[model samples]
Structures are given as C-alpha cells and as structure tokens.
Target: MKIACLQFNPKLGEIEKNQNFASGLLESYKPGDIDILVLPEMAFTGYMFKSKEHIKPYLEDAETGITIRWAKAQAIRLRSFVMVGYPQIVKGNPDIYYNSICFIGRDGELIETYSKHFLYTTDESWANEGPEFKAINVDSLGKVGFGICMDLNRYQFKAPFDVYEFADFHLQQRTKIVLCSMAWLSNNDNYNDNDNNHEISTINYWCNRLSPLILNNNNDIGNILVVVCNRTGIEDSTTFAGSSSILSISPSTGSVHLLGSLGKRQESIMIIDVPIDDDT
Candidate 1:
C-alpha cells in the first residue's frame, strides 16, 4: 500500500490559513494515488497555545466538525483514507477537549477518533487525557492502530532514571500498521540553556521508543509498519522535529530498519509503499 506522510509547519491560532496550507497538499495528489495520507498533529490548529481560552475557538466536535468535514471532503476527492490531528471537543462532554486524531475512510465515512491517551506537561493546560488504547480495521489496510505524539512515549516511571512502558498490542493483535501524528520538538531546541546532553535527533528518539514492535527479534510476522507524520518549523521556544518517517522490521531477520524519512526541517509529502502479505 502507498502512504503519503505530509510534514509541514502551521501558524498558531490561524485556522483558516492553516487549513488552506494542509488542503493544498492534499489537493496535490489525485484519486487512486495512495492508500492512506497522514498529516501532522494539530495539522491546522497549531500547537503551543498559551492557555485553554487561546485554543477555544478552534475546538471542534470530534465527529462532525470542520476537521471531520475537511477529512471527508478530501477523502472523497482522493478516494483514499485520511488521518489528521486537530483540537477535539469531546463528544458527550463538550466542556472537555483533547488533542486527537481522526480517520476518514475513502468512501467519505468517519471511521475513528483517537484522543491522546497520554499528555505532555505542555498539553496539560489545554487538553484532557484520553481513556483507552485503540485499534481499528480498514478495508485494504487490515487492522490499524492510532496514537498521537506523546502517546508513543508514555513511560511508566521517571523517578531517577527512566523506565519504558510496555506496548504489547501488535504481538497479539492483527494490526499491520500504526499511525502517529506528531509535533515533536527537536532535542537541540534546548540548546540556549547550555544543555549539551539534549542534542539527539527526534528520529533517534522515535526509533528507540518503537522498540517494543520493531525489536521483534524473537517474534514471528515481524513486518509491522509504523508511519509517523510530524510538523516542522519553530513554534515559540520549541522547534519541531520534522523527520517524519516510515519504519519497519524485516520479517526474515526480525531487525528494524528505516523505510523512509522526510528529513529534519523540510516541508514534504512523502509517498512510500509497504508490501502487504497475502496472508495478512
């Protein structure tokens, strides 16, 4: 299946302008061009808001608002599934909001809405944490999983050192692809404070964080695909890491490898294909 991962920068609080930018990229491809197209977290409603009120105007009802409408419109035009992130007004509780992702099917149907189950400190002031993990089935894609930026890094402990959270879904489930919408910051974003230890690239951070699935050394059917679409450019004190990547493990060797990368600071629409096994 061919997947397009769009990595671009978004202006803070300018929903109309940002939607146009994202829409332009979606319009660049035609129908039957790709199986799925994934955009960055808060694709239109940029991250780094100063307060909850600052983002209030952009929050939409998770299922039928502007973001969903846009996704439905684009999915209809492209004849493919679309995954994007936007500020979501909780369905049953309108007073609550979350940083979330939505999956719009090729037939212009809303398939799923996944809230960020784990929140970063920066998000706490404006967003609520989601309650559960999720996996869904798409026509040609098989079972797929969803996660936002911080959801992938939900570590169990950070007391003195660090302890990783266990992610065992892929081993037992039929999920073939996992999609992550991110606005990941570059490590060097903290350089002004003179912390030399914070120089690792976010791509390295992602590769390591995905060890539970990619490091399938002893597991069979190891070819699970992880598609990440992250934003670029600097937002306030944070410079987002833009190395959107598509990585996978080789079924033959059970070793992890990079299938594609959009690089660190460029705005791009990367099209990569993942071979689907007949059995899957």
Candidate 2:
C-alpha cells in the first residue's frame, strides 16, 4: 500500500483559506493511488493561539466538526483513509477541548479519534492531556499506532511522561506502523526550516529515540514503520519542521532507512510504497 504525507504552511485563523489549499492539493491526485493520507497537526488552524478563547472560532465537536466533514468527503472521493489534526471541542456542557487527531476511513466512516498525550506548557492553559495510547488495526494497514508531535519527546511538561518506557509499550503491542501528526516548531535560533542539516538531525534524533524499541539488536519488533506528517512555515515567528518523512526499520536485520521524504519547507504530498515483507 502507498501512504502519502502532506507538508504545508497554514496562516493563523485562516480556516477557509487553509481548507481550500488542502482541498486543492487532493484534487491533483487520483483516489486509488494512495492507501492512506496524513496531514499535519492543526492542519487548518494555526498552532500558536494564545488561549482557548483565542482559538474557539476554529474549534468544533469531534462528531460533527466541519474539519471531519471535509476529511470524510475526501476519503469517500479518493477511496483512501485520511487522518488530520485539529482542535476538538468535545461535545459537553462544560466545553472541554483538546489537541486531537481524527481518522476517517475510505467509506467516510469515523474510524478513531485520538487526543494528544503530551503537551507543552504553553498548551496547558487551553488543552488537556490525552489518554494512554494503544495501537489499532485498520482494514488495510495492520497493527497501527497513533501519536502527535510532543508525544515523541520523552518528556511531558518538563517531566518524564508515563511510567513505562517507549520500547516496552510498543514491543508488547507489536505495533508495526505509527501514523504521526506534528506541528513541530523550531524554537532554536540556530535552526530553521531552511537548514536540511537540522532537519536531518531531527529525524536522526527520532531514530535514536526509537532505536532501543524497534531497531536494535536486542529487540524482535520486525518491520516497524514510522510515518510523520509535519507542518511547515512560520507561525507567530516560530518556524515548523517540514521534512515530513517515513522511517522503516527491520529489527531482525537491524537495518533502518528513510523510505521517502519531502524537502525542508516544501509543501507537497509524498507517497511511498511499503514492502510488506521487509523488516528493517
């Protein structure tokens, strides 16, 4: 199966513009080409909102949100699975919201909705922490895990996140693929989206983090694939990492490689075929 990741820039609070841009992107592709399509975190809404009130205009209920409606329509039209991130105002009287990802199946059915587990301090003011992650099985994709940007980082609000380690968790679940959505901002002045070196290092950093769990000599998790959809461009002076990519690791052979990638700061849909038998 071929999976496509979308890397793009979104302006603050310009939901309609972003939606149109994303819609136009899908229009260029035939539905049967890609099995799954992933978009960056808050793909339509800019990620730098100061408060919940500041972003309320873009928030919608997970069940009936216009964002999910668009995704459902796209999935039905393209005959592919679609996953995108947006702020979800959970349906309730208290009006609770979270940084969330919604997955729509090929038949336009709501598959699964995941809230972000790890959040930055800045996110604490408006967003709530999410539930513990567990991999799920899709129609075509086998065992799959879902995650967000900060969830990759070992820390949560400056502290080590869960009690269990990353390796143990995935190993037990035997999750073969992880679909991730990210708005990975580069706050360091030393690094920007223009530098491919920094972007490569960032990928390397993730590889290193997963080394112990999926691609090491001691482990037996075969053919683990991590597919990332990260945002690009600057939002409120913070530049996002645009080197959205796929990393495949065959634990039996202990070999890891980049399957496909988009250029740093480029807006494009990258598609890569997955060799079912290869375990990196």
Candidate 3:
C-alpha cells in the first residue's frame, strides 16, 4: 500500500487559497496513486485565531462544511482515503467549536472523526476538549487511530512522561496505523540551516512519546506504521515545523524506521510505499 503526507504552509484565514495550493501539490498523481492521503491540522484553514469570534467565519460543519467538501473531492478524485483537519462548529450549537480531523473513504463518504483530545493554548480560546482517544477499523488499513497536533504531547505537558496516554490506548486497541495531523511549531522563530535539525528533534520527541507502543511486548505482529502530516510556514508570530514523515516501528526489535520525510521548508508531498499485514 502507499501513503502520502501533504506538507504545505497555509495562510491565516485563506481557505480557498490554501485549498488551491494543496490541490496543486497533488496534481501529478493519478487516481489510486496514493492509498491514503494525510493533511496537516486545520489543513486549509490557518491554525492561529485569537478567539471564538475571530474564527467564526472559518468554522465548518463536520459533514457539509467547505473543508469536508474539499476533502471529499480529493478522496474521490485521488481514489484514496483522505484525512484532514479543520475548525468544526458544533451541529446543534453554533457557539461551540472543536479542532477536529475527519477520515473520508475512497468513495468520498465520511468514515470517522476525532476532535483534538488535548487543547493547545490556541485551541483553549475557542475549542472544546474531545472525548478519549479511540481506534476504528478501516478497509485495508485494519485498525487505525487518529490524533491532532497537541495529542502527541504529554497531557498538558505536565503528565508523567511514562504515562504515554495516546500510545497506550492505541497499543491496547492493537491499532495497525496511527495518523497524526499537526501544526507543530518550530522551537526557534528564526529559520536557518539548523531548522532541519530542529524538525528532526521534534520527530524524535514524537517517537519517544510513543515509547510504550514502540517497546510493546507483543512480537507476533509486524511493525506498526505511524504517519505524521505536519505543516510549514509562519502564521503571525508562530512558525510551523514541517517535517512530515512516515515511520515503521518494529514491536519485536524496538526499531523505528523513518520511511520518508519532507524538509522543514519544503511545500511538497512525501509518498512512501508500505507493506500491509493483511491479518493485522
């Protein structure tokens, strides 16, 4: 099977422009070129907003909003399952919103949705905390779990490092694939030759956070696949770290293989061919 991570910079509040930019990135690929396509959190909508009132214009419905509309089109056009994030307005209450990501089937039907379980400072201003993390089964992929940007961090950045809440849940669920959509920021504001190294640091931190699953006792199954789709570019005072990558972890040997990755400043798609365990 093939997996793709679309890494690009999205300007604040420019949904249509970002959509076009992302679309142009995938133009070279024919239908079925990718089995699964992942986009960064708030994929087309810029990540930073001051308040609920500030983001009202960009809030979208889970099903019929402009974001989903765009995702569905990509899913159908590429003949691939698409996972992307957006700011979602609560169905019954217009006042409520969540930083959410949704999975669309190859036929462009909604498969599952997961809101951000851990809110970043920006999310706290206008989004509600989602329920606990969970995994769902999808065709070919077996069991797949989803996570937004802050979900990978230690809870509130205060939880015991060993807790590994997200990784533990997926390990318990025996998830074969973990898809993470992120708008992770660079530690430094100034971009320099060292930016690439900083992106590597972030990726290493992410892997260490999943140590529980990486160090799992189960040696019977194949390596688990984790795909992180992170964006690049600056939004106001924040500069995003864009080293989107696909990793394969061996449960038996505790090895983490980086299948492919994009640079911190590259606006491109990283595609990797992965071997799926049919019985997993």
Q: How do all models score by TM-score?
A: 0.89, 0.91, 0.96
Tell me the tens digit of each residue's lDDT in model 1 across 211-263. Answer: 66655564445477888898887888688777788877554464667778886
Candidate 1 segments exceeding 4 Å error:
156-166, 190-200, 278-280
Residue 156, model 1, lDDT = 27
Looking at model 3, the pairs that clash are none
1-280 per-residue lDDT for model 3 (tens digits): 9999999889999899999999999888988699999999998889999899999899999999898998899999999999999999989998779999989999999998889999999899989998888699888678899999889887887887777888988898998899999999986677653354337887898899889878986887667899999999888878888889898888888778888888888888888988887222
**Model 3: what TM-score?**
0.96
CA shift of 161, model 2, Å: 11
Put down candidate 2 lDDT per residue, 51-153, tens digits, no spaces.
8788878897887888899899999998999999999887764468899999999999999999988786656778888877757888777788888887777
- Tell me the spans in candidate 3 whose CA falls farther than 4 Å from its real position: 192-198, 278-280
Q: How many residue pairs clash in each candidate at the backbone level?
A: 0, 3, 0
Q: For each candidate, what is the lDDT?
A: 0.78, 0.80, 0.88
Best by lDDT: 3
How many Å off is the CA of 77 in candidate 1? 0.6
Residue 68 in model 1: shift from native, Å? 1.2
Better of 1 and 3 by TM-score: 3
Give the winner by TM-score: 2 or 3: 3
